[model samples]
Target: MSIQTSRRALLAAAALAAPAIWGRDAVAQIRRGDELTVGIWGGAQERITRQFCATPLERQHGVKINYVLGGTPERRARAYAERGRPSFDLLYLNIFESRQAVKDGVTMASSANVPNFANLYDIAKIGGYAVAFNPVTIVYDRRKVAAPMTSWRDFWRDDLKGKVIWPTYPGAQGTSALLMAAKVWGGSESNIDPAFTNIARLRPFAAIQGSQDQLYGMFDQDVGAASVEFGSFTRKYAETRNPNIVIADPTEGQAIATNVACITTGTRNQALAEAFVNLHLSPECQAAYAEEIYYSPTIKNVSFAPELAAKLILGEAAVNKLVDFNWDLVIANQPRWSSRFTREIAG
Candidate 1:
């Protein structure tokens, strides 16, 4: 059977077997024909979300969920623009964006309504309901680089000259890498000059990649030796496309790209929105996400097999080791950094 058919079958079986999984309170609050609009990402992410959360919620409660699909920038822009009278009931944002959203009063803060909010790990509490933790690490071609990467400084190695692909500015990979570059050279978020100065050393890049697919293509062609990338993308690509790819947790540490879901500040359907967020945080949905895309769960309730657990950032110890940044400071400096990156580095 096709993937869509299988998903439908699974939903049917789930509804039949345990409709209570959605919770009685949510079922009672949601009336037939109730509509909820959400801003979310598209493609496989959308498909899996529908299968595990949206479709199941619809079936269980007889509600209609209308999705506004695109990248985070558009959704974030809309959230801010429509703050006074927001159209979307919920939106998915990255960690920094979500924190900014809350600070700007465009998104609602955690409340008793979102009971599952209490189930998440402390690191996932970034002003919104965090869904997954994506580690930004060094990804290299194993066959090309015989020396395993153990630190962020490895990017500047002479052996990998002219083969490194840097992430373009205005992206998670780019921002994380820039900060990492700063930290490795004695500068930091508070003093970011070193990143621009240091990053210039790795000039003559193969490409300034903007998307995982672009980077993956370069890796497949043997054009890229190493680069800063998300663990989810690298691990996913390595497992599905190329075993030669390998991820390294730098000696300096790993940077996390936490993805979040939030209730719009002026949403008319607060109850429904909270219910949807709760379902998305459910162990079943979180587990499905980990299995499909390799995004580590935000909740402590979910468990994975040993192999999968090793690949994910699970438990308090692993969570605490991640290098934390002053995101407010980072976001405030983004515009200036973006310009410098273009002129000095990628230019």
Candidate 2:
């Protein structure tokens, strides 16, 4: 092994007080009846997590998992407000929120804490250990959008005029969409002027939705042909509610981010928290998440069933077609971005 890998292995060995299982450290701190809380988005996500992740952890490690279910925004609010005393041990927060969590001294730093971190894709490690990919893309009602939408710029096509919607700012999908817009339209995170200018022009002809449900509702009514949302989210809504709705792989690529997992800084159960974090990156957990939820896995070379693999954003071909943004920039200038979207785009 290389020097770095040996050192990481030693670090993991020193931390675990018991034998390893499944090629991962199983520390004594994760004893029977000991509990670990995991915050996740409610509804379908929580369902899949319980069946695939929580049950197995409980069965194997004798650790009880208490899932704290809420909307992403609500859970993030709790994470920030609680900080040193977060209600959960492991929270599934967006990359931006996770990055902010680490900056605010809320995350346990280093791959040493979550040893499986070393097994993840490089992009997934950027803002803590990303557990799942959330590719923000152009979602449309296939029946209404006869031609495949080519790009975010397609929202402005003459045929789509007054028949398009824009995600409202201060929302993750919207913020990402606008940022993607800025970059593609000769503006950038540092210079969002052209983006706002063009957005203002499109405003009069576009509908604006503040939440995913509202966006889905607008699509149901044929109020718009396309809008921005995470690929997995689009799939979820399509399978359960709107069969005609589908994700459009834009020629310019989809804007990608992730739902990251981390052990909070002040956890009373640090070792168990770290263990659970490792399980999240485990091939088992990663595969379930990919297959069940359709969110891309972060671990390198995870094996998904053939049908499941078809639903995933896997392989180099799809990975190369994803657009990534600077989370630091997104987190830092959020206020200005929100204000611009409200004043210039939503007006």
Candidate 3:
């Protein structure tokens, strides 16, 4: 049978068996015509997710999807504030926010809810079920820098001083940059002193940017030469806005925080939530998402088209070059790190 047919059969069997294995209540919780609210970022990410996953699933199953779109900070804050009565059943969060969700007791355990969770990489199967990623590395105006950057340490290059942008601490890209600094500057998750010292030293040269919006006009306005940005965004920007923009894979590695989809504790339709998360991880959906949005899928086997192969993180060789951080460790020391970043790095 076809994949969709098999899925329908599985749903039919599961619904019939749930009453005996789980309870009548669990079966009733996600009956036909139910709507599953999913919290995620807005813009391209939202549109692509709908095209690749939400719309398809809604058609396959008798269900609806409601998108709760916002910034990562807003979604994270709301997930925490609502707690047991969250407005969303599914949340798409980055590695740090996913861990925070677990710590705050707002997400369901994937081991119990999502059967396909085992198919993801160990890193993807963390506090939340990682569905996608955007590998962040060096993005520069090729016209400005004669020689290509080959190391993460290139961020501190004196020749490129005052031309680089520093991400503020406590944000996704910011924390990833911190971990990058620590790794290349002789520090690790256990020791971040090197990262801080380097940040303080580079503060005078590197301008701090809170969001990508600030970096959009960097080249045209001459605010700076280049900035650390996600390869996905930079590639699209290069194609559409600035052909001068080019992404460099630091020999050290590009730091990426996996984006995950998790069922929240307050979900009234738990079964539908789990299935939606599972379907989002399917290779068909993942491939469509990767091609449409340029974010890497967490699946082990999906491949991109030839034209996209060089631009996106795909295949084993590229995947191995990814740098991951210890979110728990980052959060534990965030109080001190955030203060120092404000007083020293951005001061």
- Candidate 2 lDDT over 10-110, as tens digits, reads 33332342222434445535667788888888876776556545665677667788988787777777777888987778787787777777888777554
Overlapping backbone residue pairs in candidate 2 total: 0
Total clashes, candidate 1? 0
Clashing pairs in 3: none
Go through the candidates in order and give each one's C-alpha lDDT: 0.82, 0.73, 0.73
Off by over 4 Å in 3: 1-29, 112-115
Per-prediction TM-score to the true structure, in the order listed? 0.91, 0.85, 0.86
Model 1 residue 112 CA deviation (Å) reads 3.3
For model 1, give the RMSD to the true fold: 3.8
Highest-scoring model, TM-score: 1
Position 201, candidate 3: lDDT: 71
After superposing candidate 2 on the true structure, give the runs of residues whose Cα lies further than 4 Å from its correct spot.
1-28, 110-115, 305-307
lDDT of 1 at 24: 42
Q: List the pairs of residues colliding in candidate 1.
A: none
